[model samples]
Target: MNHLKALLIKFVMIAVVLIVVLTLIFDVPFMDSIWTSLVLTVLAYILGDFLLFRLAANRSSQNVRNMIATGGDIIIAFLTIWYMQVALVDANGSIALGSFIAAVIIGAGEWFFHKYLDGNVVSKNTRTTADLEADYKK
Candidate 1:
């Protein structure tokens, strides 16, 4: 239930940002922007948010962890949107600009979302070996 809620929030946020950047700002097609947004959202949620959080293992400060997650999101957003723009719009100059804009926007949202996940989801879902051992002893 929590995972579904989180995914829904992420999807809406990503879709809005992509729509505004691609359709309103860069003049890309609406449907193409939506498709690219959905793809980026799912990929980033899995690869950037979930995977990176697991890899970090609560080893760093929340800010640092968020940075790492956001960095991954930025890279993913840039690459995915750039490719989409190039293929769909045949855009050369706008590709880099649009991708950069989308990345920055997504990165900001991802930072906050990472914090939320750390507080609500990841902390609930993960436990260290020591924690498990202590629980067994109890």
Candidate 2:
């Protein structure tokens, strides 16, 4: 339930950023913006939030973990938006600029979101599944 809430929050943030930059500014179709948002949100949460953020948090300070996760989120956002626009929408030359803008905005939002996750959702000292399994076997 908590994870679901976090996912929804991340989706809304990505969706709004993409819609504003891609649809309103770059004239992308509304549905394309939505599709891009959905894909980016899922990928980012799994890779950036669930995997990278948690892994980095184990070894680094809160600030360092946040920066690493945010950087990963930015890269993921940029690639996903760029691919979606170029391959699916066949967007104009402005696609790169629009994706860049949206990605930056999403990264900014993710920094704060990571903070929220740290305080309210994700624990900094979580154990990996492998560790748990190894302990159980011992």
Best candidate, lDDT: 2
Number of clashes in every candidate structure? 0, 0
lDDT tens digits, residue span 1-138, model 2: 878999999999999999899999999999999999999999999999989887774433679888999999999999999999997787788899999999999999999999888887876467745446656889
RMSD of each candidate? 3.8, 3.9
Please give the CA lDDT of all the candidate structures.
Answer: 0.81, 0.89
Q: Candidate 1: where is the Cα deviation over 4 Å?
A: 57-60, 128-138
The residue-level lDDT of candidate 1 at 138 comes to 88
Q: Using alpha carbons, what is the TM-score of model 2? A: 0.88
Per-residue lDDT value at 85 in model 2: 91
Best by TM-score: 2
